[model samples]
Every structure is written in structure tokens, then in C-alpha cells.
Target: MMKMNDVAKLANVSPATVSRVICHPELVSEETRSKVLEVINQVNYKPHIVARQFRTQKTRNILVVVPDITSAFFSKVLRGIEHVALKNGYQVILGDTENNIEREKDYVDLLLQKQVDGMILLTARQDKVRLEELSTQFPLVLACEYIDGLNVPTVSIDNVSSARKATEHLISLGHTKIAHISGSINVILSRDRLRGFKQAMMSQNLEVESSYIQEGDFKFESGYHQMMKLLALEVPPTAVFAFNDEMALGAIKAAKDSGVNVPNDLAVVGFDNIKMSSINEPSITTIDQPKYEIGKKAMEILLKLINNQELHNKKIVFKDELIVRGSTRKEIDVKETLEMV
Candidate 1:
């Protein structure tokens, strides 16, 4: 019920001054802005968001399309995006595609129709033709995931290098019989991680056994099932590397159910370093991608695109860190490594 005019009168300032104080506080004088803010707080004044949107021709709404909302990997990223967006007086609308191309496309269409000012996508599965067409009409930035050979602006970590580091950690831990639990091969991150896995094996003069690698859908259940298959192999792996923390946790559960002693019998490592990783019975060793920073940077880039500002490149790659924990003990040395088929 509080009005801007009432605040302006109480502050003894003109309505235009009050408008600047609310919309562009930085442009107003410190003393005047302070007075207006005091009156605003005293009256519990609320801005008419709808009226402002109508006047500014901006919805102040951004759509974030994620592959899965339930994954802890995305929770920090969303927090970062929300932090930056709220500070800039914008709102975020979230859409979960569940890694389904059709669902992704549907959300894209719906957000477009809703006239959101910009969009940040963590699922970039749209066909090249469609993506090119959409990019021409709207401000869009890809986050976490990206389409190969596309010019869309993206924010993500160096997947290949981080994955290689993870594998190398296992190799240095006296484990040559290292198996990999890969995510869906179609995703770029999955392919990159697989490539890194092979590269690490070859670097150490170890044989790359195709049978030692299994594919999962990046889900706990898929990881559980794939790990079971790995355990049943005639020559079981001495250590396993999962594509993400969620899968690694699932694999850990499977290992426990089969009475396998972690690290002692089978070392395990995961990626993404989700919060749960540290709290697991045997804390997981994994790669930590700056999930929150990735989200914040993606939104910052999209905001620039919306304003038609020049961006140096369409691709932005973030750095990753390898965090060692109890799941992969550091006491073991390379001299004790076993030879594999």
C-alpha cells in the first residue's frame, strides 16, 4: 500500500529524484539517497515491479535450463546465479530438462514465448540449425554443458584435463588396474572424461582395456548397476573412477553391499566434489569444478549479450581442482602398482 510519491514527500525530494533513488541509486547523491532509503524502510515501501517492467520493456526475468535440478552439483551453481541476479534486481526462472532433448526444446520454446530477457542453459542439446536460429533472436548463454562446434557462449571447466588429473591420481596410487565409470557418451563432458581416462593410461605405459570401462547415465542407480557388472569381471579393477560424485556414491554403496573394503581393496574417486562426497563413510577423492562461479559468470555473460555488448569469445573455460580424500589413500606409492591386461 506504500507509494513512491509518499516516500518522496516524506524525504522532501521530487518524484524524479525518488525514481532515480529507487531505479538507479548509484546516480543519486549519497545524502539524498540515504534520506529516501530511510523513508522507504520506515514505510515498508514496495516497488511496483509490474509497472516498472512495463515501462522498461524488460521482464527482468532470466531462464536457467538445467539438466537435472535434483543433482547436488547444480545446487551451488544455482545459488551463484541467484546471488548475482538478485543483486542486479532480476529474477530467475528454473527449468529442469532431465537430460531429455525433447524436454529441453520444450522449455526453450516456453521461455522464448514468455519473453524472458535472457537465458542460461546447462543443457545444450538443441540441433545446430535450431540453435543458430534461436541465437539470432535472443540472448542465450550455455552453462556447464555445450554443443560441439557451436558458437554459443559457454561457461564450463576444462573437463579433459581435470579428468586426466583424476586418473593420474589413481595411477600414482599404485593402481594400474583402473576402471572408469563413464556417463552417457553423447554428452560432451562424458566424452572428454573418457578421453582423459585413456590418455592417462597410455601416459603410464598401461594397456587401455575397453572391458574395464562401462557407461552409466550419471545417476546413482546407473552407477550402482554398472559397478556390479565391473565387480563380476574375472579381473576386477584395483581402483575405479566415476564421472561424478553422485555416481561415485552409488558405486560406493554397491561396493559396501558386496562387502568390498574401500581403498584397502578397491580405491574409488569421483568428480564434481559435491558436498556429500566429504561426508560419505570413506570421503571421496574427486575433482572440484567452480560450480557457483560458473553459474555467476554465465549470467554475467548473458546479461552482456542482452545489452548487445561485445564479448571476446563465445567459449569460457573454468579451472578445476583435484581434492584428495580418504576414498583414495595417498600413502600408497607408484612402486606398488599392479600390471593390468
Candidate 2:
């Protein structure tokens, strides 16, 4: 293993300067920084992360807790976090809560016992009172999901505004009887999205009928079942908006199985523009939350907090995009004319 002393001798700079180059490169002159980097690369210098952690009282390890690791939505976020963490010479430890409050609490306790430098949380539950107590001892960041009034730093999209935009898009498409399928209402994301949906409908002078709204667990099966129930309503909705892409896909599947022609008999829109949404038949029109960027930004914030650096900005909000596709189309004439031309 190449030591900092060897790099210092090779670059003719102090070991402290070498450390500064590795950790705080901006403080050193560009010429000196480049010289130290060149020597580091030549010698394949690998810093002793454990020793550094012990000396600095930082583990240089961050725990990222997700509700479900299998979801494609979260996988993209994980990739983003990994990119930033690896670049910063920090290690990320994953904790999959499976949406279980007890399991989430257990993971938090374990990570704290291990003395991790910080934590990035996606599975924030209302029962995180214990975790809140732990934050007094260590830094914590909330990603994707937030706990209202928690005073924790968070990185997320503006769910309320984006959901309103999505609903307004449907309204612009001449959909008056728009329905909504949502995740658990207890979660902040779900509550905000639901509020947005209602606000959009109310703004347009459209009644938000409780009978048209369905609740799901943000799962494919939950979506499928909920859509089936909605389809059985006395006055079935002509359009439906799902809180996430998986639910939207599930609704599509249910509509097809029920012999309903999509965008003709039904128009479906989803959130979180996951990859499958674009590839699915009649491709879903959905809100594109920058999942990967959210993950990366969250990790970046966590790393800064872990290093005890001043975070110039505490809350980071990513923008959302609306992707139009065939699933929500009400007319083929415009598309046909464009294609012919």
C-alpha cells in the first residue's frame, strides 16, 4: 500500500498538503494539486479508509435506507448515490426496509451502533421518533420521501406542484371525470400528490368525487385491484392518474384484461417516468421525477454533512417533466397528419 508519506516525498510537498489535495483540493494551488494527483496515480496510492475514519472520528461510510430495493425507481436513485459516493471516496451501505417500520428502526439502530458517518433515508416512517433521537448523535438526510415538521435535511421533487401539473395536463386533454390511484395516504408523498390532485380539479370547477379515488400500496397488484374496483363504479372514470409508474402499468393491464380500449375507453397517466412506462404498449404519459439526480444529490448532501462542512443550501428540490405518449391520446388525427407529412 502506498502511504501519504511516499506521495509527499515524491511530490516534494508536506503530508498535510497531500491530505489537503485528496480531501480539499480547492485549498491548494492548481499546480500543486495536479502534481500531488500525478504522484498518487503513479504509485496507485490507496488511502487507508479505516485509519482515516478512526483518526477523524468519521466512518466515511453512509447508510442509504430504501423502502424496497427491488423497485426500478429506487435502483436508479441508488446508481446516482453510488456515483457520488465512490467519487468522494466514501462507502455506501444499503438498508432495505421493505416498508416495515420495525425493520427500519432496527437498521437505524444497527447503523448508529456501527458509528456510520451519516445516513440517507428513503423509507422515512412516522414512527421514526427513535431515529430522530439518533440524529442528535449523527447526521441524517431524507431522500425522495420526507417526514413533515421533522427539521431533517431533504432532497426531493416538488410532489405537490408536479402532481398538479400532471392533473392539469389531463384536464387540458378534456378529461373532466379524472380519477386518482394513490399510495398509502400516511406517507407525505402520497398526501401531497392527493392534495395536488384535488386542488387541480377544484381549480377547474370539477368536483373531486370521493367515489372516484382509490387507494393502493404503490404496488402492481394493488394498482390492478384498485383499478378493477374503480372500473366497477356506477359512473366509471374516463381517465385515471396513478401516483407511480408501476401502478399506471398495472391499471393499463387491468383495462386491457377487462376489454377496455386504452385512451378510447380509458386514459391512464402515471408518475415517476420509470423505464417500463415508455416501453409498455400504448406507452404511458407520466411525470418524470429526476430519480437518479435525487439520489446523487442526497448522497452529496450526506457526504458534506458527514465531513462537517457548511451546507450552503440544506433543501434541494429537483424538477419534474411531463412525458406525453400514446396512452393518454384522445385523437389520432393529429399524429396521423404529422406522420404523413
Candidate 3:
């Protein structure tokens, strides 16, 4: 019931002084601030946040665009984003595009309409021209994926190199007949990871068999189907590499359904070491991407852009780690690692 004017009148200060005391405390004299605080406490006054936002021309709401909200990997990343956003007095709005470019564009329209302060995209599907144009007019940061020509800041690990390292690990373990379960070819990340897999095979003089490669939509069902197809092949792969832990877990299931024991009969590896990777029946050997850090760092970059600060780097690439687990432990001779090359 108590309003700003009522507080000012009770404190014997003008309304403008009261506004300054509430919005910018430092702008008010100490005496004026103390008096206003006493009145505010006595009245239990609550500032109108929406009105304040309107006056300041800032919603203090950040939009985070993700490919899929159901994916555990993106959920983990969102936790990091929420941590940073909350600590800095901002709110986060999630936009799950479900890998649809048109849906992603709809979320971008929120930024253009001043409904959100800024945006952090997790593997954006929008065209380069539109995204580039938006970047010039808004604060935008890319997380987990990047486009080469866009000058917008990005936070991600090197997908190609990480994929190469993962493939190399399988090769070192003497998995010459290796099959790759790749993500959708439409995204740059899938293409880069596929390239890495091929490069590693080439370095070891292993043949990259076309039949051994399968395309997945980065879902558990796709992984299950692909693994089944691979198992039915005349010359089945000794080991399988999946683009994500979801697929890796799927492959493990398919191998078991076919009465095959993991790591013994068929070795399997995955990328994006999500929480389920460790808790699975046979834990997956995987490329550990810093998912949480990527989200946190992406929000940090977006904040800097919103504050009109110069970014130290346009592209921030975090390092990926390889975690060996129970999923792929078929050991081979150390000398064979050399022989394989």
C-alpha cells in the first residue's frame, strides 16, 4: 500500500530524492539514504520490478537457446548458465528449438523485440546471414557450437580434434574394424567430428569403410537403430564410436540385446561424458567436454557484450579430456599400438 511518494513525504525528502535512494543509493546523500531506508523498512515497501525495468530499458532477462531441453547434456549446461545468471542479478529464459531452424529464428525475434536483454545460443541452427546481422545489433554469444564467418563471440571445445583423439584411442586399443555413429550432418559439430574420425583413421592407415559409418539424429532411438544395423553387417565392427553418451548407452543396450558382452565382445566409446555415462551398466569411455564451463563462459561473454566491453577473444576454445571407463577396456599389446600405425 505504501508508495514511493508516501515514503518521500514521511521521510521529509522530495520524490526525486526518494527515487534516487531506491534506484541509485550512492546518488543520494548518506543522511537522505538513511532516512529513506528507515521509512522503507517501517512501511515494508516493495519496489515495482517491472516498472523499474521499463524505466531502465532493460528486462534483465537473458534467453538461452538450446537444441533440446530433454537432452541431459543441455540440461547440465543450463545449470551452469543459471548459476552465472542468478549470481549476476539476471534471469534466464530457455528456448528449446528441437533442432528446428524456424523455431530458433522465432526465439531470435525476442531479442530484436527487446523482450530479452541478450541471448546465448547452444548450437544455433539459424542461417549465417541472419545471425550475423543480429550480432551487429544485439549481444549474442554462441555456446557448444560456432560458425566460422560470424564475428560473434563463441565458447566451445575443438570438436574435430576431440573426435580425432577419441578415434585414436580406439585405434591404440587395436580396434581396426571401428564403426562411427555420427550425429546429424546438418550441424557443423557433426561434420567436424566426422572429419576428425576420418583423420585419425587415415593417420593409422586404416580404411574408412563407408558401410561402417552411420548417421544418427543425436537421439537414443537413432543410436539403438544404428547399432542394430551395424551388428547385422557381414563384417561387424570390433568397436563403435558414438557422437554422444546418449548414443553410446544405446549401443550398449543393442549389443546386450544381441547377447554380446560389452568391452569383451564389442568395445564402445562416446563423446559428451554426461552423468549417465558413469552410472550405466558398463560405464562408457568418452570424450569429456566441459559442458558446464561452456555455459558459464558463454554467459560471461554475453554479459561483457551487454556492458559494451571489448571481448578478449572472439572464439574461446576449451580443452576436451578423454575418460577411460568400463565400456571399452579390451587391452592390446603396447607393441601392437606401434604395429597398427
- Candidate 1 per-residue lDDT, tens place, 1-341, comes to 87878888999999888877766554688888888888988899888878876776777789999899988999999998998886565689999998898989888886568568888998877888788778888898888988778878889988889889999999998899999999999888899999999999999999888889999999999889988889999998989999999999988898999888787888999999999999998999999999999999998888788778999978999989999999988445456654321
Q: What tens-digit string does per-residue lDDT give for candidate 3 at 1-341?
A: 88989998999989888877765554567777888888988999887879977786777789999998899899878988999886565789999898998899899999999999899999666788888899999999999988877878888999999999999999998889999999999999999999999999999999999999999999998999999999999989999999999999999999999988899889899999999999998999999988888889988888888878888789999999999999888656689899999
Task: List the candidate 1 regions with Cα displacement exceeding 4 Å.
Answer: 10-14, 17-50, 330-341
lDDT score at residue 331, model 1, on the 0-100 scale? 48
What are the root-mean-square deviations of the candidates from the true structure over C-alphas? 4.3, 3.5, 5.5
Segments of candidate 3 deviating more than 4 angstroms? 2-46, 331-341
Q: How many clashing pairs per prediction, in order?
A: 0, 0, 0
List pairs with backbone clashes in candidate 3: none
lDDT values, one for every candidate: 0.87, 0.86, 0.89
TM-score of 1: 0.89
Local lDDT at 98 for model 3 = 88
Q: Rank the candidates by lDDT, best first.
A: 3, 1, 2
**Model 2 stretches with alpha carbons more than 4 Å out:** 1-50, 128-132, 333-341
RMSD of 2: 3.5
lDDT of 2 at 303: 72
Better of 1 and 3 by lDDT: 3
